[model samples]
Target: MITAEKIFKSFGTCTVLNGINLAIGAGSTIGLAGPSGSGKSTLLRCIQGLESPDSGRISREGYPGFMFQDFQLFPHMTVWDNILYAPRVRKLFPRAYLEAKADRLLRHLAIGQCKDRYPTNLSGGQKQRVALARTLILGPDILLCDEPTSGLDVAATGDVVALLKSIQNEETTIVVASHNLDFLVQISNRIILLKNGSIGADIVPQELEDPIVHLRGLCD
Candidate 1:
């Protein structure tokens, strides 16, 4: 499980996150919902080891992969090279063994056709998909995504969302930060609503409906 204890964060005079506590179990998806600047992305980044919080402690018992909202692909690297970077960094296995693993991951991710393409040549959805493939190549224990469907059209969002669902079905921990409440209800087994830099509501799948409306009232 991934857990956080009494988390707190501030920037100069503005307090961003205040005393958050959470436990996310394995093989489940949790949705984080809140208004702008509510610290949803920050927490995800902290979990992904992209940022250090001002104060707080977090513990992850397993490896975690993070999908960035901006599709942070290496601008100068080819798709294949991008996915191979992590394995090389950790020396996941002998070079030949890791190469075989990368080949299998590329095929599994359905990006084998794009192995030679550069990030700039792919569409937004394709770029995100490539980012997912790169992250998954590392075989993470958890997957954390930030606003992954934010700018895609409905059809594209459905495609991306379904990709996420298909990946999660294989029994990995999934956590997503999204503004789309309707979609969240369909994908997440639990929901956490953040309000005024703290947890406003946390509930299981049965209670996630109309979360945005409820959050609006609380924020007002």
Candidate 2:
């Protein structure tokens, strides 16, 4: 489980997160949605300790893994190398186990054919899958994604949604931050809307007649 209380953060003069409070249960998939500058990324960063809040407290029960917005795969390494590098450096698992896990993840993500290719040669969606495989290889209890579907076509976006759903397990928590409401609605069980550094609405998608319309405030 993860909980935040009265969280506040700023960058010099511009305040980002303002007195935010929320709780996330284990195995829940949460989507943080808002317009640009709405604090979605900041909140994810804070949760993962990439940025510290000036006030309030956040408690996380397990290890958190972050996937950056840019899909930061190493340009110098092949896909296989990129996915295995972190665990190898940390010595978290034996070489054979890591290799096996990487192979399985690549196959599961439908990128097995690209394992020998470099990031420069792969498409945006392929890079995203590689980054995901790298993060999943570490077996984190909590996974955070930032603008996961930013640069993909409709088919690729669908692939991402399906891949994410396939990886969902009772022990792994997933949090995705994106401006795309439709994408979030498809993948997240709960959607939290942000506006002007504060939560505008916290919704259970299944409870609403139409989550996207409600999230957009189209109905009275």
Candidate 3:
């Protein structure tokens, strides 16, 4: 669970987030939809502590794992190494245990054969899965994904979306920021429309007869 109260963020003379308030429940999938520059990415960064809000408070019940729009994999490291790096550094578990976990995650993500390959050698979808494995390996309670399907083709997008949905359970909360309204609607129980750095509308998928029309009305 996560709660943000009166959150505000600014860059130079531009105000990106204005009194943004949010309450994300456990196991809920929240889709943040907005026009470009509406602060969806900024909000996600703030929640994950990658960026600080100028004012107000954010309280999260547990650790959050962030997946960037660009798969930030270590180009020099093999896939296996990239997945194990964080856990190895933290030393929360034994090396053997972590290695086994990495194997399981790679297999589960259907990227088992990529373990020996470098990030540069993998496809966009493969890289995305590798990034996902790295994040999920940390055992995060909240998953924060920024443009999770940003650069993929339609087929790749479908693959990533299906993988994400399959992995989500009653114990993990997932927040995805994306421009793909239909994809968001398919995966998220709640869709939040943001306009000019503020919440414009919050509605469930079934409540809208036409999501695209409603989204255009609110954002455009």
lDDT of each: 0.79, 0.89, 0.88
* Tens digits of lDDT, candidate 2, 1-220: 8899999999999989999999999999999998888899899999999999999999998989999888888899999999999999999998888899898888777889999999999998889878888888998899999988887778777877887898788878899998788899999989998888888999999898889988887212
Q: Which of 1 and 2 is ahead in TM-score?
A: 2
Q: Which of the numbered candidates is closest to the native, going by highest TM-score?
A: 2
Give the Å shift of residue 66 in candidate 3: 0.8
Best-performing candidate as measured by lDDT? 2
Over 109-192, each residue of candidate 3 has an lDDT whose tens digit, in order, gives 678999999999999888988888898889889999888777677876777678778768898999999999988988998999
Query: What's model 3's lDDT at 134?
Result: 90
The best-first sequence of candidates by TM-score reads: 2, 3, 1
The TM-score values for the models, in the order shown, are 0.83, 0.93, 0.91
lDDT, residue 184, candidate 3: 92
Q: Can you list the residue pairs that collide in candidate 2?
A: none
TM-score of 2: 0.93
Candidate with better lDDT, 1 vs 2: 2
